[model samples]
Target: MNDIPEPNNESDSSAPIHEARLWRDDGWTARVIKNEDDDGWAVEMIKDGEAEPALVGPWTMGRDKKNPKPLDTGAFNTLVKTASEVLRRHEQQLHALLHKSIAVTTDSGTINVVLDIVPDEDDPYAMLSATDEFGDAIAEVRVAPTFKLTRASAEAWIESGYRKPR
Candidate 1:
């Protein structure tokens, strides 16, 4: 019986269940199931409170060849580690895309600039801001999400008396 019911976000999630081919613990569930692509098996690692699995990959065959390797503490731990790393990398990439920062020295002082983007479905936008060396906000303005922030642009903005970039 591979038909394990998944818990929804609003309900009581994060339950722990340990079975032969299905194991749930530590905010993740590991399930070994038949691979739809081939006669081999596949394992999926789903984080608790999430409907979709975070990681899915081929599984090793057991001694019987026809059977899938059962879930164990060691295997489950490895899967959790891998899936966690995958999520971490994805988050890092997203942060890199949504946020940018640059620092430069001018006659006034060192200015730290940052661009934060909001990827709204209906109204995407970004906020371009700058702070002095003492972490005092110098300027902040809303800009198009497509705004490109660079050292030259920062210098130009500073030279323009912190006016909205054209």
Candidate 2:
């Protein structure tokens, strides 16, 4: 007879599917699953309400190569921390890639300069824009994604009447 409990149909969708080697916490879930590439164990850490796992790594093997070391408070806590860091770094990197902002002082007034990149498979482009202190858009232009945005470049663009870069 199997000792593990069956999944409760009444449980919330966000709730982790608990088994012998699965654990659910407020913000994350840790589950031990078979490593499809090899005859070993791997652990997947899924964040709350997320469809995909934030981290998937090898699990320590027990005396039997086929069995994984049981998940404990210490191990689970470490996994949670690692997985959270991974998600944090990924978010930071994506933010940097999609958007960037800088403050510049122009003859008119200090303005917030922003560069928003739109990545397309065939053609990538970026939008360069500037806003006044009151959040009014002063100027905007579309440029290549590789265009370098700096104080000098922004000043030049504004001086050129928002002309498309050469």
* Root-mean-square deviation (CA) per prediction: 2.6, 4.4
Q: Per-residue lDDT of 1-166 in model 1, one digit per residue for the tens?
A: 5553344447455667677778888989898878989989999999877878889999999999988878889999999999999999999999999999999899889999999999999999999999999999999999999999999998899889889998
- lDDT for model 1, on a 0 to 1 scale? 0.89
Candidate 2's residue-wise lDDT over 70-103, tens digit each? 8877888899999999999998999898898888
Structural RMSD, model 1: 2.6
Candidate lDDT values, in order = 0.89, 0.82
For candidate 2, the 10 contiguous residues with the lowest summed lDDT are 1-10
lDDT, model 2: 0.82
**TM-scores for every predicted model:** 0.90, 0.70
